[model samples]
Target: MENNRAALILAADNSPLQVGPGPDQSSPAADEVVIKVAAVAINPSEWKMKEFSYIPLKYPHVLGSDVAGTVVKVGEEVKRFKAGDRVIGHCLGLVYGGAKHGGFQNFTTLREAVTAPIPDAASFQDAVVLPLGISTAAAGLFDDLKLQLPSANVNDDKPRDEAVLVWGAASSMGSIAVQLAVAAGYSVITTASAKNQDYARALTGGKHIAAFDYQSPSVVGDIVDHIRSAKGVKLVGAYDCVGFESSTRACAEVLHELNGGGVLPSVLVPPEASSLPAGIKAHIVNAAAPGMVAGSPGAAVWREYVPRALANGSLRMRPEPEIVGTGLDRIEEALNLHKAGVSAKKLVVLL
Candidate 1:
């Protein structure tokens, strides 16, 4: 636990991420593992958190969520992983708040519940794309949207005739949401830019997934009509991965168009309450809300489902990471690019 380094934000809001020596690594506590971070991915939340200071921080915060690395140490109570295990995990610096838990650092402490072993064939760069994207999508599709749990074995498959709307299917979170919903046996109708239609279609997991250009003027009507007219299928719910006002409202409108009411649409960002349609329930999904509890839905994902799915190839690192550069020094630039907006791609930095 010496000489480890990290990228730190010295001040709360109005600051840049700085590369420098970080605190010495600490011995893992029960239920925790320490990792030598091999790769990290940038998410919009990190930049927003740095700018807005929305989530509580203890000044000099470290902000990152997605991480892929090799295990350096494991705690006394840990049984699932050991030293030298290759893993992908969701670091909790954004929620837990510190450099030790942050992904920007050379060494990070990961809760066993939120960490999973990566397949030998997958690279850290590709695996790093899964942590946050998978967590957010799983939280929405499996918990909030209440879709059927995904299965790796085709023999145990159950068929369903419901359709799900994945607005912003080109975004990292949306791409995974589409895959998860399709794996759960629902027909997926999703929106992306005209350019990303092929990318979205590729992730449909051999299930029925329809891609529409969200920028088209008739997107709403087109989605509504498609879902409404699809033979023998009912619109069960939607997941608005881009939770901006327009996307959120579009989800509600589609649900309302399909059925008068009683449909749920889970969103990443909380949409304005005033803009939500009456009787159509829209809820904000906090991917980290499952909070390390043993029996929680988040636990099931990180502990059980993610590991099996990753091994079986049922879950994938989607939209692919566009390597920004190497080293912690490149994180700020990568994050700025992410904040500026990217389509059908995730920004990644190898450490």
Candidate 2:
């Protein structure tokens, strides 16, 4: 066993994360793998949980989710992985409560089921940006909504033209949503700040996407007009990454108007219960639901789809991380930047 330092939150309702030394590292379980963490990314859940005290807090809890690292040790029964493998995965921090130090520490552990080999073409930083977004997007697009992918033939042509709208397209989650939707043979339309339109376009393969300022009054109208121009919207589906009232209402309105009958999947709290339009379903995506954790059926679905997509390059990693911090001391600052909203890139910390 080796001792390692980590950052922890000793109390709930605290804005700052406390950095301090904690327990020594122990050997991995027979089914688990020990990782020498190379980089970690911050997500909104980290701060939201802290601010709202969303999850029960055990004193000296570690907070983080996204991790990319090299395998240093593997349990006796582990077969699919070995030491020296580079990997990235979504940490089940929320499900495991806040006690685990997550990816913020120099060393961490996870079951092989929750992780996969990083694509050889992608860097540790780029790969770290994927697990959460890719998992959530894969779950929503393939598992929840049952969207279909194109066949092997290049000219098969099986409805790769249906329009799907992605609200908050510039967000890490939203960016993944747009890319996955397009890869699944659906045309994508998304909303974001005017400045991020180029970034969104690059991710979407330059498809028929429109970026509108979230602050604009005509945002909904602009989206509606785009959908209308795409011809009759029979198979309209929307993915809302921003859960704010305005974005949700606007997406709800556009989907309702365009499809006249379809479901919209949202990552945030569902749209106001009573205000939902007829023939429209609002499916809430709880990415961390226990069922999606390692060894669960939902995890099976993700493990199946994400690896194939990633390995074949159907999905591309996002831009290189813009900011990289070192150790727990830099975690609080990274969380603050994420809370204030990131631009077109992600911030990561090297553990």
Candidate 3:
């Protein structure tokens, strides 16, 4: 029997999204595969875009970024993946030059470039949580900042001791950034709420991580003091997972304190810092804009780095997501929870 189920759709105004069953599944394109989505992860962009309408949202647009599912069908030209392959990928959502549909449905279609086989060890819930954040973190730390990976030869005498601070370490992207940074041989100092401190340390392989409550007024000073006290804190860099004004400003202050004589990389737009300390640079992480397919750089990164990392175990699945509801009917509640703020955990809806 044909699968007919409701999908969460965004109206033209980008207002509250609605869940409704609209159409039957469409055949895959030559380079596409049809996936029976098992889980979908929410991202801040889903709500942020509502205000800007930056991406063209055709009426009834689907808004979701991360997905893990089984491939039920594939088009003639789809080679890297086949039917029955379990996979996870960034949905790219319909608004941002993405596929015709997104992951927030019982089924969605994706091109070969953005899809990758999920690890045998990962569950659908955990697998879905990694792609979007891990991909961005990899792109930011490795590609944008041009940081080198550690060599196998221990005596190679490379500067593997330099530290990189990950602001907002408990966030999904922040959490992944810690792991990727540690794997690359940089000591990681991250900030998270007091409750998530211990969990943050385990995720990053237990390095020089420190958790600070963003709610505390002294958070900025705490980060700066931590970096300054570290031995040989030269050539420092940072990744700001939270892009709010305060988070960016706090990171900026710490970077200024470090004064490592190089640019500090940020995943979000950096705050304007006049009178910045000497030898500090700030670059916004446009992870999706590089090596993009048909002028989409984000897609290119997803295609290139995501697969190898998964295959090599350089990236691992996050905590298993709590799957809330199945199909489109559950979207409104999910969005409401996202708007209200997640409690240091990811909320996913199965489709």
Candidate 4:
């Protein structure tokens, strides 16, 4: 009977998540699979959505986006996965507006197109960090910025001359972005605090990555100088994972210096379009949007890259999971901790 379980439910805007009777476990649809969730990662978007109520949602909505679990059911049309497969999936709760699509519940329905098989070596806690972070990073780099798709094989040859700047290198998204860009054969220059420089470099897996201190007053100049010093490299642009106006403006300033006056920057949060500098194109990316669409670059991340990368060790389960507590009861505690802020790590709950 425990399979018929309770979920950490969000009753209203700014309300604390309360455990309540979860929706009746539903059968998977064509191209869908149902999972018995083993772990779920906490993301900042969950708290922001709970407070702002920006995305349209019904009362007592479920809030979570990253799920890692064992597949319990598969739609007849599903081909890549079967019942009992271990997987990591991106939940479509905010995009689809349904509790069935959310990850806070014990059982969740995932689109087969947006689910990836996990390697046996990875734990649910480790794999849970992949879904949302991978989605956010891949969306910015591949979808909005149009960087070349990464291969599962690492390029051991000389690093390519293309360079990408990832602002906030220690955040979950920033760490993954650095790995992804480096895997795609671009030299990655990223910003973290002084403490995380080594950690950021570790995420790049011995690839061409340079980590700098974002707190320094001359951070922008540091990036510009790095670009200038690298001979024959074109600034492919930057991904601003921090997404505040200050971070966005700093990214734009780095680009302005990189181009001697202008460049386009891809941002994770929606930006005030008017605030951008001349010739600076700001692409505000919604990482969740790709999972909702078929054949989208964001969808390909889960469908193709994540599974292969995980198996081949090209994609890492990173920033690493800092498990707050166990069980559905701890969801609220994890959410508060996430809202309070964490450094260079992801908050997670093992269900």
Could you give the candidate ranking by lDDT, starting with the highest? 1, 4, 2, 3
lDDT over C-alpha atoms for residue 294 of model 3 = 56
TM-score leaderboard ranking: 4, 1, 2, 3
- Candidate 4 lDDT, 1-351, residue by residue in tens: 135455555555487777877766566788888899999999888888888887778766787899999998888898898878999998887877487788998888887777899988899999898787777788888877888877778665777888998998888888888888887888988888999988888886656888889889998888898888888998887888887787888888887777744444454554666776666777667777567665568776667677788888878788889999899889888888998999989999998
User: How many steric overlaps does candidate 1 have?
Assistant: 0
Can you list the residue pairs that collide in candidate 3?
A: 288-297, 288-298, 289-297, 289-298, 290-297, 292-296, 292-297
Task: Please give the lDDT score at residue 332 for candidate 4.
Answer: 83
Q: Which residue pairs clash in candidate 4?
A: none
Model 1 stretches astray by more than 4 angstroms: 155-158, 262-268, 290-294
Give lDDT for model 3: 0.67
Question: What is the lDDT, from 0 to 100, of the residue 177 in candidate 2?
Answer: 80
81 in model 2: Cα distance from truth in Å? 1.8
The residue-by-residue lDDT of candidate 1 on 247-266, one tens digit each, is: 88888888777787554545
Kindly report which residue stretches of model 2 are placed more than 4 angstroms away from their true locations once superposed: 23-31, 75-77, 149-159, 208-213, 289-314
User: What would the per-residue lDDT of candidate 2 be over residues 1-351, giving only the tens digit for each residue?
Assistant: 266667777778675777777544466767677788888888888888778887676677777788898888888998878888888867765675234426667787776667788667767877888777766665566555667642212222344557777887778888888877775667777877878778888785575555667778888887777667766544457777777767777777887787775666777777665787776677777676423444343365345655666677656677448665777688888888888877667888876
RMSD of each: 1.9, 3.1, 4.0, 1.9
Q: What is the clash count of model 2? A: 0
- Residue pair clashes in candidate 1: none
Off by over 4 Å in 3: 1-10, 21-31, 75-77, 94-99, 149-159, 208-218, 260-267, 272-284, 290-314
Better of 3 and 4 by TM-score: 4
The residue pairs found clashing in candidate 2 are: none
lDDT of each: 0.82, 0.71, 0.67, 0.81
Best by lDDT: 1
Residue-pair clashes per prediction, in order, are 0, 0, 7, 0
